[model samples]
Target: MSDVTIQGNILTPAGWLSGAISFGERIAGIQGAAADPQLNGDDYIIPGFIDLHVHGGAGKDVMEGGDAVHAIARIHARHGTTSMLATTMTAPPEDIDLALTAIGKAVRQRGKNEARVLGAHLEGPYINSGKLGAQPNFARAATLAEVQRLETMAPLRVITVAPEIAGHLGLVRELADEGMRVQIGHTLGSYEDGVAALEHGAAGFTHLFNAMSGLHHREPGMVGAALAHAEYAELIPDLLHVHPGAIKTALRAIPRLYCVTDSTAATGMPDGEYMLGRHTVHKCMGGVRLPDGTLAGSTLTLDQALRNLVGLGLDLADASARVSTHAADYLGLQERGRLVAGAYADLVVLDRDLKLKAVYIEGERCDLNDA
Candidate 1:
């Protein structure tokens, strides 16, 4: 196929440029001049969003297995996500296995107009049951053998573990040594426990300040540990999972903080009930929640995540990094997040209002209307 070229106010790694980017499956060339005030326009071209924690979208839950992951990938691609992890919920081993098997297939057989499935993000089964958050009551302890078996089912790129659990600290070290991105979440672990996990190779915190312990002047729980020591972590920027004030505080503390959707099956669907692993959650009041009114996940898409960050007083470039570049960096993905030459031709086009106008994955334009 011939090269496809797009011209706009391009967001290059250096900064914004008034130029044209040419690409086919990969970026071939970027030609442009410095930003010209006289030619300022409404159009902006930025790298596609990368979501590290994604549960479901478009009426499909990841735990449903089969074609569910495919539907979720296509729906998220419509909202400017070029890639994401197939995040699973806490359930029995058989359920988790089914989800991962489906995710592995999707990763290998990425379909047309679908966001690339990077790998499986095992978010449950091995966690502290006391702080289950929206997770089911199936929390258990981690074992290297079990994790190794799961890895064989799919590429376990990222896993959430509660270091306070028995033998979990050592498991964190082992997984990190093996190159998996271990994250702290769904735990009642103390501040010291959080610190020890970080020292033992826990690379990040999952949905910071939500499922984990909170920060107090005396206790300085997991949230405090993250604020004090974490170099990378993810926050749900839907403006609901975390308050704006708290999000601001985290922004000041963590330099490599990124954004995630934590979206549920109700995403892109009308207000209703949907399955989140073994539990059925309600989608209402702009949030997904359990019957007891606990926040389950979220109804956010990445484009809206970008807008929410900008609304929270972040500049457009900084918001873009949170939604795209930072997550890519966290995953050690060199080719998917930025619009520089030699990267994959994955990107999004937006108007001055930050609304997605078009999306491209591996140089193929998506049909936004189909979303």
Candidate 2:
């Protein structure tokens, strides 16, 4: 394939560049590009944001068919996310299959809109029922055969399960060996049990401190263990999923701190009713929830998450690391999530005010303001 270069003020691993980069059609290196298109940078040029967890946006849910999925992807891409893992909340196994298979196809088809689909993050249907929060309790804990069937569905990247479930640890290791990230979340497990799963290769925590137990001096729950274990913790920084103070606290507690946006289908839309999995959540003021008003998912976009970080007194470099650099490291996507030479030309440009200016996904200008 021929190269389509993007020459602009660049941001490399070393730092911002005074010149630009030669982006190729499936970028290999500078020589990879057939032609170099210069994009003069009056804006901030950084690697495109990668969202590891998100449901939907732009008044559409990923669970809806093609149009909705593609539309949601476009909406996020315009806002600076070049790629994302389409996350599925707890739902029936049949629905899970449909969503997973559809997402796999979307990734392969390269979404009618430009945001690349990394894979799918099946956040439930494998979690504990007793501890279930926003997720429908009826959609909890599938049999082993049910969970195993997912290996054939999509590139299952991350699965959130409660380790305390019987036969869960075995399943955890099973998923870990299959190259899927096993994250302990939406559970009520003791510190020892949580640590044991981590020792057995459970590598992440989902939306820390929300929909889970709180830390205690005597009973140190999952939150306590996650805080104690510095190397792992992917907290959602939407401020609603967690309070601002708690967001600061978790960052200080964890050594390898990172941010994730558990954005629901209602993100970037007017507040109202929306469906997530088997339950319908009421949306208002950027928060999604169930009928009884229990907080479900969030209405946070990657842009808003970054803006929140800035508002919380974090500098662009530090905030960018948590949102972009650190998250890529956690997912072990060796080549993505950074602005470096030879890396994929997945980039986003923003104004000094931090508003999204444009985006390039794998060298294609998802937005063409500069053109």
Candidate 3:
């Protein structure tokens, strides 16, 4: 017998269809609409969100250690993220090492109350200081020895780099060769530099249009290259990071653009002080910002990101892909991000209005109503 079964208007790879998914650890079977007579017919069953870029939430910063990993994962899990990369910020070498060590431990010890930690997304040290955004004061050039050591420290699935940094284009090629998903971000690289990184094997863009070079009509910088080249870009659809008009523009230009929560420790918490790397961030006015008023990550979760896209008039399937499938595909995670017989039994159930009601990872439902 299956451990659990849920019936709803499910989104499948073929398209949205009415069905019931029965499962153990992975999906054991799929049943047609008629099979579940008890189904309410108003709930939505879509693949659990997989966030490739997320820093922390619930007053927990990833740099705080492995326990912070569980804290952050549990917070996002309550809102429909079943899997994610535990992201790190630009800090001193010793601090980054500590975060990576903690992330590696969390991957092995994850439980039902938390989202599965796929790996780490190191978002700093190798990035440019010109467009540091919320990152701290310790940026540096990419070094092969440091990256190679970090590679052994944890399962690094992605790294954000500036192609214009001295000797970084070659490092991008090397990391891509090793199957790491290299993304161009936090930089002042021009359009030509972005094209060069893509040519050297970079596969994605991180939190597009934030901290990166803008799309000037004449210069056509990194933003223009990302849009024009159709690179797999992760965007924060929190409605504050990029305006609705710019989001619509990105949607039209990039075919594989997806959503990520570059959330800070203030996310899911009351307005107060919280940490983003080494800096203290203020959370208020429905957003997070630094002392200088720079956008310091966001207070967004993936569930609301889905609602924002649909609110912008995107069809359900397309919005679903942005939060789940596109990021999974970019990381080459074949077994997750789909609600099929062979995929992991990870998903979220939403009410008719698209509000999250429940979340499940590996067939076990998380405590969404916890307060």
Candidate 4:
């Protein structure tokens, strides 16, 4: 028997479709023509947004503990992010372990609230110091032993490493062989280095255009390489990470640009002083900036990214592919991200205006009408 039947516009797993999804606790089933649960005739159902590059939100850091992960995750869940990876910045090896350990625990343990923790994304410590956006330089470019230690800690679904960093690219292959997705980021590598690393098994790009090389005609740096490998690129389209026009150009070149908020502790907090580990980041204008005006993480939400990218005139199916569908396939998550029968009924119900109506973490619903 179905526990809850949500009608309205349901974003199904197959794609954004109009149907009723009935579930008991977690996703039990997708209610269609043959199910007891009925749906509203015309509500927009979208798969809950999946953020692969989020650090913290709702004034809590994921590194704190399961409580903190739950707190931050619940807040993003309100925004329709049914699943997320708790990302970590470049910190000491011990600190990274703490965060990853916490996330690993969260993934194994479920609560009555919060989005599902699919896995972890180590965005730093292994990254190049040169491309460290706001990560402390003290703990940069550790040896392969250190990288392997972090990789094997839990299930490292995604690791951000610099290809040009001392033998890091080789480790990228090992991680890939272990069925982990490796991304290239935080580096000063040339185009050739990025291309070679891709040949070594790097499947995606992390927060493209932030703390990485800019595209130059002659150099055609990492940014250029990502653009060249459109089918294999992930980008943060918050306008702060990459310019709007640049986002447009890259979208034209790259077919599979995914959107990530890369939000930090200051994300849901006010525009004042906020903590990002040992450093303090301030929200200025619409973006976060370090003490010296370097771009720290952002406070953007995925809903905002979808509206912005859609405003850029991309097709709806293609844009949907970039966020919900493509992100799932990228992480090799077979069950969720697409709305279909016998799949996890984790999704977001939005209005025609693209604002969130109600968000479902698994089958539980949270009203976002006030948000």
Best by lDDT: 1
Q: What are the models' TM-scores?
A: 0.98, 0.90, 0.97, 0.90
Question: Residue by residue across 211-287, what tens digits does model 1's lDDT show?
Answer: 89998899999999999999999999888889999999999999999999999999999999999999999999799
lDDT of 2 at 299: 79
lDDT of each: 0.93, 0.75, 0.89, 0.75
Supply the global lDDT for candidate 4.
Answer: 0.75
How far residue 293's Cα lies from its native spot in candidate 1, in Å, is: 0.3
Ranking by lDDT: 1, 3, 2, 4
Clashing pairs in 1: none
Which stretches of candidate 4 lie above 4 Å from their native place?
8-19, 25-41, 142-144, 367-371
Summarize candidate 2's per-residue lDDT along 142-211 as a digit string, tens digits.
Answer: 4557766775767788788888888888878877887878888988888887888898889888888876
Minimal lDDT window, size 10, model 1 = 33-42
Model 1, stretches more than 4 Å misplaced?
36-39
The sequence of per-residue lDDT tens digits that candidate 4 reaches over residues 92-148 is 767778888888777887565577887788887777777778887744664656666
Best by TM-score: 1
Better candidate number, 3 or 4, judged by TM-score: 3
Rank the models by TM-score, top first: 1, 3, 4, 2
Cα displacement (Å) at residue 112, model 1: 0.9
Show model 3 residue runs off by greater than 4 Å: 33-41
